[model samples]
Target: MTTASTQVVLSLTERMPTTRRYLMCEPRHFTVEYVINPWMDPTTPVSTELAVAQWTAMKETYESLGHTVETIEPVDGLPDMVFSANSGTVIDGRVLGARFRAPQRSAEADLYRRWFLDAGYRDVTMPSRVNEAEGDLAWTGQILLAGTGYRTDPAAHAEAQEALGVPVVSLQLVDPRYYHLDVALVVLTEATPTRQAHIAYYPEAFSPGTQRVLARLFPDAILATDADAACLGLNAVSDGRNVVIAQESTHLIAELRAHGYTPHPVDISELRKSGGGPKCCTMELRG
Candidate 1:
């Protein structure tokens, strides 16, 4: 290989970036799913039930921690509609309109345009397909890792990356459980793992080439134990050092604390039933 290429590869390997941070929805927006989730049932008239109370507590907790909350009216189809924080595909000043994949919330992307504009994010462009969502995109030290399986495709990720004038790698996902890359992996960058980025996980589904790519980028990766990985919001957001993991991931809680990180645990058990957690509900623009 060329000397220049080798140097570039070496430099790119295992280098972590600062953890990006972001805000969550406020009280009004937090109570969204109460109206939409029941539509999935299609039985009796849709009801908000106890979601209002849940959203209230979640909003208070988020605000108590100093995060700005976003609010919006409940749209019919997208139950995850309130997690506007999850719609986080930004570069420079541009917002990558999430390409919707799940029909249940296909309209979520439909709602992104207005949200982006209202949120003051003007430079918005969508991946080729009109269905990609914000949660599908994962940034590993500026290198975009797109997970394609049931929710997204390689072509979709390629289009988004190409348009953004960035490098991207399709991290093919093993379906049903690890729906998005964020759910299966949380990027521990210089912000969280001390300047060494780790694509934390327990899956053995990558190809040799893919494995090589990962190793070359972040070599200090820790393939987490199932318990540490799954319940603790394994693939959530972090600001290089601090993380927002699921409260259920108790062991990881100890690990992060031992490493000197100010970890925040969010109770997302209710969302888990719908294939979501911390990462799925929010996207970190600045960790």
Candidate 2:
């Protein structure tokens, strides 16, 4: 039986039509895996129960703000399916379902296909060959930057952009640890109502290419502080003057204030542990 899908996953390209716009998504569904990253190994022990509570609270928070959310059902055998961060590359009207780079998380495509189709995304396309998940994709309206590192490849990124008929900028990752794009980058500006354009990426540490790309993207760029970047400050949603950030990311919250913006912080530690911060978990679709 086919389940009815009412939400329309929006594309960044459409949001970028103007300057700054307002866009918010309801966090109705989310998942947090049992095993955290190998690097952040904590033998202290964590519970899936606690994680779900956080996820549920996050969803409720979004609902309070007035947006609908859908639970992306888990596919058998894939533990990470609970985390719908690695799903697709959405821009304009195209919703390109992703192919996972991690062999363990590859089953997400078969699971997510229904959501895209049911949402009325007809221009869906896949790589003729093979590719990584869309979580590795960074959409900035004008340029779709793909991280060519652990979770993504040249071919996969190229295929995604081609399918969408858009130009892509490949950010070569020297640090193998920050493999997935979301870990290192997030589009900070999607505040516009009609056209939701992002502020692009700002590497807190330092990256000349990163700065150049951002400078080129926005004429009057809002430089988010490095302290905020450390706390995933750069990974936030901006509604013009209002900004929503992760609770644990302290530096980002302060930086947001310095730049003259009201910051709304919520606990997203569970989401971060599962390889998604704030931006990864959402695909904005407003017609």
Candidate 3:
């Protein structure tokens, strides 16, 4: 790992020229109320107060760094609403809505749509197939990396490409633990004209074919260990330079610093019990 004094640290503006905007939700009624994914276990208890405090801290962190942060009202019986990244994908000033696989989260589709429309996202694209939106789809600065074989259907990738007018690369997720693409992959920066950015991901979470695809596309990408993946460390949010991640993911943080990226660790342990961290609670609003 690179030592603090020797590390090359880039300011947010130098790394990302555009102001990063995000949408988040308050953990007002957040809980493991239903078991929709492997991470959720309703039998376990959840501290709503702690979840709120952690989420508020995350929002403030973004604002403190000169980024824009917006909020969506949390609805009752929608515990997973706190994970706003699943709501939809915003690209090129358009919102591509999500079609949740589970009925427990199906209502979220409409809730997100209403917010998008009211927020002046007139070019909203609704999907005919099942898609979890940004939860499985993320921009790598050059292309859209879409995940399937779990929460999002393979067909949704085609729809996303058409709706967003961008090239889409489909990667198959084999591990149930990393059900969402965002859980296994962390895009370091969007590709710019002068430079190609990189990503950090857990190869074990993907199928062999998808792993090979990633290895081929990103030969110099960072690889997360099983321990780090289990801590949901790969599920991170980066503004090209500074990365906000789970405080417990020390190894990953060291790796990021070694790669000249500053890691901002936050204690979202309460939210991690529900299988989420900084990235899960944040949805980059490109539109």
Candidate 4:
């Protein structure tokens, strides 16, 4: 039952793995002390040891995949610091530090800023607007896809664009559960000279107009099921070919394979108590 259209589609799905550099933080003091997102419940008991173990496994996974993984020192009392992807958005060696919207996480921004500066990143700029960095901003190689209506302010979209010199497309999130853009959308293949960029996202997480915009922009984008999205499947990190995702997201894993992606599943259940998955714990250092 092979069709001409299916053959063409399969032929066009040429995927190649690219070596990536990533920044991560060990969940040494990780815990859900307060509620910032719907996924966080302070009442639920958390295990710091379990979080560390899971994080270590994830770090190893990236290393085994031929990617460079860098770590940042975690400050005490900032349990959520483990979600290092929110530290900032780094593009072409230019660093745009995060400005947290929540008071509980405000202190984290400066710590991350200092890290970037001390790490020899001379072009680091701390944003004035309330932006949670990679939590709401996703770089698709060609343009930046930014999410607003939750943790990040729409105004930060312009700030990011000006700072990074990349065109930014603002997508409005309507669901609090999918508060950050990373929780709802993942850039699968970043656009290059020969291929168009591809993404996988949950339509329900975005507003009607925003959903339409996504559809128009990525007609071949994979759509996540409700069950997959609930497990933070969209909160994944893809190196063009290999996608590091939550093991609980079985459906998304299957879909990723159908699309010619090799999905590497990791158990970050302990960290998910604080609303983070693989992508939340790993920030890509693009240059």
Indicate which candidate wins on TM-score: 4
List where candidate 2 sits over 4 angstroms from the true fold.
Answer: 1-44, 128-134, 190-211, 218-231, 238-242
Candidate order by decreasing lDDT: 4, 3, 1, 2
Candidate 3 lDDT over residue span 14-64, tens digit each: 455346999999999898877767888888878999999999988888887
Count of steric clashes across candidates, in order: 24, 14, 2, 0
Put down candidate 4 lDDT per residue, 1-287, tens digits, no spaces.
98977865784478888999999999999989898889999899999999999999999999999999989999899999989899899999999999998899999899988888888999998888999999999998899999999889899999999999999999999999999999999999999887899999999999999999999999999999999999999999999999999999999999888788899999978989999999999988887
Models 1 onward score TM values of 0.74, 0.73, 0.94, 0.96
lDDT of 3: 0.87
lDDT comparison, 2 vs 4, better candidate: 4
- The best-first sequence of candidates by TM-score reads 4, 3, 1, 2
For each candidate, C-alpha RMSD in Å?
Answer: 7.7, 9.9, 2.7, 1.7
lDDT of 2 by residue, 1-287 (tens): 33222111122223222222212222333343344343233344445565566556655555555556556655545545654556666677776776765566666776676777886779888655345444567666566777764556678767876788778877655444455666566665443455445453445432567556656756544554545555555556544444556776666566555444556776666655554555555545423
| Higher-ranked by TM-score: 2 or 4 | 4
lDDT of each: 0.57, 0.56, 0.87, 0.92
Error of 3 at 134 (Å): 1.2
